[model samples]
Target: MDTDLSLHASAPSPPTSPPGPKGLPVLGSLLDMGSDILGFFPKCAERYGDVVAFRLGSWPAVLLNHPDDVEHVFVDAHEDFIKNRFFWRQVTAIFGKGLLTNEGEDWLRHRRIAAPAFATRRVNDYADTMVQLTSEMLDTWTPGEVRNAHADMMSLTLRIAAKTLFDASVEADVAAMDNALNDITREITARFSRPFVIPDRVPLPGHVRYNRALRRIETIVTRIIAERQRHPGDRGDLLSALMRAHYDDGRPLSDKQLRDEAVTMLLAGHETTALALSWTVHLLSQHPSVDERLSAEVHRIIGKRRPVFEDLAELTYTGQIIIEAMRLYPPAWLIGREAVKDCEIGGYHLPSGTTIFVSPWIMHRDPRFFDDPLSFRPGRWTPEFTRQLPRFAYMPFGGGPRICIGKAFALMEASLILAAMVQRFRFQWGGDRPIKPSASITLRPKGGVPVRLHERENS
Candidate 1:
């Protein structure tokens, strides 16, 4: 594949780089990025055209707002671009060389080993566990009870992730895992945004807390791997599949590799899915009519029984609601890539090593692709609407070879959890305060989403 923009094959010469806002000397647009991470791209795109060039600290960068350009980076010439070193450097300490952060052949090998665990059949087998865990959590809630919807979803998903992936009971480690994950995510987000932040090796206040949290996580993962090795039995879980896998060269994964992959799955598997569900509930609360439609669909398809894998295909409206919610508030909001060789994107000349930013949050809401882009309308995701849209317009799970490995697992898990909860309870706005989005490792509800739950009379 040519590094130049294949979408514009007829262009006579490479186009000049896109226009961007001026920034401070040395610091460039780093402060703007640090100040409002979520708002930054749209602001730039509104001022500049589809493609914008700027800097993050001393690094040369471009932001691609159009779906065609996004497709180029994520799919057309994927090999010419690699994961942004600066962005991944922040969490590589925690994730190591796991599939989420690894690159090249190493990434391929890890992906190959982990792929079977997420196959349609295997993911389908885990559907019952998702509904069972969600039911258990819902049982603890009372009608008219006020709850932080974000926290509730997080706790529920974490439990589901643990049980489904590791075949471990939630009682032993869910609390500690939750605390550690919070601290690690907070610290990583802080370091990633600020260009002038101190190095992790230096013992800053945040670094100290981050290290402590990391150690707790390391302890938990190490113990799990150790116990699994001693038993060496098939538990019908992801961990078992990974343990039993071997490379083409007849080599098994080392203990360190096992730990890294396990931690990556646990973090990525639960965190983003939980956030997606939380945002879905928040959107439903504000749009009661949409909620009614969604509830009615769930009732008609699932009735009072727990959701099953086969019911997913029949719950068309329920799927559309989740799709629309993610379009508005994608958990993995921004994707970054670095040009390994000079390239032209949307006719812009990008030099080697240029950092490129693609935001699903911005693109999904682009008025060009979506009608009334800001409105919360699940009905917009009809078959004709989706079929006619650009492929890159709705990428909550990303795209290409490096797209999220857990995409199927997450969609299934979210659908089941949403279906189960909606059938039993109806949520209402619990407070007068408006909730804002916080762009951290994942897009999260600022503070938390406070909502009142009313149990259904029939349920």
Candidate 2:
């Protein structure tokens, strides 16, 4: 049984400054948020109510828990908002002028160029590659071996991303890329906590690692872009697709533009899907009944064969398990959008430059929107249930036009990889202390989902 919803209920404060906990006078919620960022927001919502106002140092911020308000910022009134510069400026340091950082027409053009490659028909073509890579990795796993499933999923997804993007196996290049990404994410996480951030030009040791990581990424992406330019043709990979794209006036994309799009796809494409699968694997290990049900579904639908893109339709239960896991542990945990102009949301005044945070982590677990929100219940995702819920209530990929472009690509990739893994191995979570979430920008399993593998016998 779940906790009673009535016990957790609270009322919103009056419209004066969108009522919330008034933290320390000078530093505001800085210490509190820094100590426990994920738990802090919900605690405010629980006590101060839905439209909770808080501060991240001098910056005025608000946490909007309801889906209608989420819709306002993400969709209905998006034109009046921009990616919160406080956070995205740091992200821009890593992503450059990629789709993730670009806004307005520049963003539109890049999105237009890259969109075709991720179209369902086109994305489905990579199903074989997704499963093939998973199979290759599974072949390396020993039945009784203890392994970091998160690391395994990360490596496998990176391999798949490289093959699908570069049309070459980057197995040899994986370690360098992996190390580079690790350093980059670490540097960015450090930046997020600090209200007063040190400029990247400063030769701090962390900044040095940050710059070195950028160079490594640049080297690999540059090599691939240069090669593609020298031999430009449609190769059915993402890079080739971008290389083949042209502006309406017949102008070709600049080298810098190519670099931005490539790095964006290479990093964002693999990381999110990898995290989704990692969490799903972790959740399945914790609940054997759920795991067994998932295996039965995969076996029934796939029948001793690997899953193809077509099988995704019949793999409904497999899809639900992944969906439920994401609801429990969203990869892109929080989204920050700053208002460019004053606006009204939830019948309260939001002034210009207010950074509004709409966290999927908090919203997905709201008792008002979901019954027994704390439990891992995949079966709740029925058509009627989804239809009844507000659109933003369960947005793992986010909402609106600026939503993740790789949405189709990601869902397909996660589902296929998850289905394939269960078909081959059963995980046993032999733990000392329970694995904890290390949420910086994305929520990751702190150390990794370390578990012992028990290979499934052939049917």
Candidate 3:
């Protein structure tokens, strides 16, 4: 009820705009934002209260830092807000009109078609594949050998996503796919930070790289679709399910629809989860006690055996660690939505076309909702703590109708993979290099986390 700014209710004078820092003329905080995107929100909130207004170039924007305000945008008045134009343009450029980018009935239809593939039963079935893939990756590691945990994770999860979703082996194409994904993410991020006038069609260096990446991705997806078409059957994977799916009117998705959905799953389904695992490993390396407890739990539960789907429920502490890691460094750190109609939120009058920003990175660490918010304490995720907390306070995968469709899958995948890896190897920071979090399409370690692997003797 904190944001119950109903227009019909009796009001006390006209509502004033939220307070924020005044920046340089025209550019308007753009330089500061680009300098440290991750730190910008908390700085604004600390200085100007939770609901702070700012400008992205000349466009007016507001950062909703409180969980209740986040709830209003994501759940209560969600219908009035749609994906922000700036962010969606970049996402749609790569993902096309898939579930992640589509809106309205198209979104609903696509959601329905894709929903079955990620059902509880289906995701549980994928747990074996998750463990299998993680174990395969671990087999290549040697004690005292340094590795880029982020790259290793990206490669591992990409393969799992490919096999589980498409019943295809992307091992041969992993390098190509990884390079393309990196190019696209880098290009889009660059576009996001700069002024908005530059079109993707223009022959900017980044744009050219982005288009090339797009072609590479299209080639991969197109090849997969063509093969599936040639010899179609229920392969018991997402692509097969999508191919078999039919609308209420008995029509099927077009080849383009299939391609878009496939590529969306390929990009989103792997990258975010891999980043989560990488950060978890980094955090675990720093916190030895937490790591010890996690190892103990994994050994006690699975003990020299691969984790099964049912083991996920009993791996409660492992789940807590992943949850806490995401809380500290959520892969999807920021959520952007634009007002479709003039609306009031947190007592501020936001006109139509206003860009609304909600950041999990800031809200997750807000002292109001979390005790010892800056500390990395997996024990803090008790049932009582979660029950009392606002739902939006910890949206690592987002919230409401558009909440990540792969929530269950990501959790299960992360938990299973964490259990599998931690049971076999102990990771330590390879050197004194400080790993910085980069706020791009997903939160990633700036250079990549370098870690030395110490094989567990008992295992």
- Indicate which candidate wins on TM-score: 3
Q: Could you give the candidate ranking by lDDT, starting with the highest? A: 3, 1, 2
Candidate 1 structure lDDT: 0.88
Q: List the global CA lDDT of all models.
A: 0.88, 0.87, 0.89
lDDT of 3 by residue, 1-459 (tens): 545757457857867899998977887888888888888889999998889998887778899988889888899989998988867877676788988888988899889888889988888889888888888899999988999999999999999999999988888899999999889888877766765757778999988999999999999989988998999999888898889988889999989899999999998999989999999999988998998999999999999988899898899999999999999999999899999988888888888888999998999999999989989999998999899998888999999899999999998999999999988999898857788998888898988989999988668
Model 3 regions more than 4 Å off: 1-11
Which parts of model 1 are misplaced by more than 4 Å? 1-14
Query: Tens digits of per-residue lDDT for model 2 on 1-459?
Result: 246776776787645568887888767887887778888988988987778888877888899999989998999988998888878878776678888888888888888888878887888899999999888888898888889988888888888888887786778878899899889889887776677878889999999999999999889888878877788788888787788878889887888888888888888888899999989988888999999999899888897888899999999989898899999999998998999988878878888999999989999999888999989999999989988998899998988999998888889999999888889889889667898988877889998898898888753
Per-residue CA lDDT of model 1 for 1-459, tens digit only, reads 675658657757657877997788887887888888788889999999889999877788988998888988899999999999778878887889989889999889989988888888888999999999889899999999999999888888888888889987656777788788788878877776566656787988889999999999888878878888889988888899889988889888888888889999988899889999999999988998998888888988889988999999999998898899999999999889999999988877899999999888899999999999999988998999999999999999889998899999999999999999999999999967999998877888987888999997658
Consecutive 10-residue window with the lowest summed lDDT within model 3: 1-10
For model 3, state the Cα shift of residue 63 in Å: 0.5
Candidate 1 vs 2: which has more TM-score: 1
TM-score, model 2 to reference: 0.94
TM-score of each: 0.95, 0.94, 0.96
TM-score of decoy 1: 0.95
Quick one: ranking by TM-score, best first?
Answer: 3, 1, 2
lDDT of 3: 0.89
Of 2 and 3, which scores higher on TM-score? 3
Select the stronger candidate by TM-score from 1 and 3: 3
